[model samples]
Target: MQEETIKKFMYMNRKAPYGTIYALEALEVVLIGAAFDQDVSLAFLDDGVFQLVEGQDTDGIGVKNFSPAFRALGDYDVTKLFVEKESLEERGLSPDDLMELVWEDEDDDWAEKPSIRIVTRDELKSILGDQDVILSF
Candidate 1:
């Protein structure tokens, strides 16, 4: 019997949810990576933060709102969503403007805990440096 090696995979999203396919494609890749049981993390910087914004209405854009798919990440054990603080501030947005995403901790009696982590640019850089593999979108 051999122990499986889990590599740290980080998906970096730097685009808005709509107006392009980058965001959506990155999301699907994240879910696929999670399915493989690899250690996964998501980093949202620049316009990527917009992907997590709450109350997104795309009727006028004729694009199907995919914000809800973010909430389902926890079900795939894909937590550790990192948002750059400077990016949010630069866009005049705050954590409150984003959707509240959480994951259940089975060890803690299934208690829900936040999955989104707000980090400064320096902090995010350090976190990114620690990843075994990083896929940018």
Candidate 2:
């Protein structure tokens, strides 16, 4: 059997969750990409961090709040979620302000682990360099 080439795929999210469809569309792509069983990672920087902010009330705007979808990514094996620290700080948000998302590591005794990773801007640069392909939204 031929071995599947596992590529490093990174989704660069730089837009806000609402006012447009970029964030949601990116998420749909992420879910589909995860099915390929590739090394997938999601980077939330700039206004993209807003997508992780808790208590998003879209009720007034008549939009369905899809923040809960992030919590479901773990089931699809999409676990590497990186958030820029400076972006969060600038937006007055801490990790506590985001939803608690976790993924089960089947290779590591099926242990539950936090999927979100808080990284500095420098670390984010390195992360971008490490990706084989980057899909920006």
Candidate 3:
């Protein structure tokens, strides 16, 4: 990545950590982007919402829980976090079910918060269309 280049990184995490590598790998990449000072955003849909829920008990699988790591994202300046509203509703979750990890003040009108920006499925698709770089894990 060059300072003169404008690059945007987007991640679509669609699987659960216990069942696949998506969530874990995404987390690692997000951290790496922060280290490199790149612009990055993430969307959680489908089973990916499981990644944000609190009290993730991965003890049985010997993998450390990752939800808490998200709390540290602000320090890295990777602040764009969107969760599809329909995805939460489909999974029987409201924004309240999640921990604060988004642009809360400006996005407060939305039910999803801390800093959540709610989007319909179509909007989600449209945003993905603009991703200069897209990663699906």
Candidate 4:
């Protein structure tokens, strides 16, 4: 039997959490890809950084707040969440504005580690270049 090759998949999100379905759709796809044992990572740039901001209240918008779902990504082994630093700066935001996301590293005796990485645009470009497949939303 041929060995299954695990492909590197990167989902690039460039939309707001609400006002459109792009952010949510990309998240769902990321989970599906991870379930297949593929290498998966997420890139949040532009308005997509808003997706991870803490204290999200959608009550006034009549939409269910899906921010909590991001916390569950680590459980699914979808831990690499790369947020572009420039994007946050442009919006007058910082890493402190994002929700705290961590994953348990079993190899490290289950020590908790952060999943979100605040990367520069140049760093993100290199990461995107290394991916086998990149789906932008």
| Clashing pairs for predicted structure model 3, backbone only | 102-115, 103-115, 104-114, 104-115
Give the per-residue lDDT of model 4 (tens digit) for 41-86: 9999999999999999999999988889899999998889999999
Q: TM-score of predicted model 4?
A: 0.95
Any runs in candidate 3 off by more than 4 Å, and if so which? Answer: 102-113
Tell me model 2's lDDT, rounded to 2 decimals.
0.93
Badly placed stretches (over 4 Å) of model 2 are 1-3
TM-scores vs. true structure, each candidate = 0.95, 0.95, 0.83, 0.95
lDDT for each candidate structure = 0.92, 0.93, 0.78, 0.92
Predicted candidate 1 versus true structure: per-residue lDDT over 38-69, tens digit per residue:
88999999999999999999899998888899
Candidates 2 and 4 compared: the better one by TM-score is 4
lDDT for each residue of candidate 2 in 1-137, tens digit (9 for 90 to 100): 34598889999999998799999999999988888878999999999999998888999999888889999999999999999999999999999998889999999999999999999999999999999999987
- The residue-level lDDT of candidate 2 at 130 comes to 98
Q: Candidate 3, residues 3-31: lDDT per residue as tens digits?
A: 77767888887786667777887898888
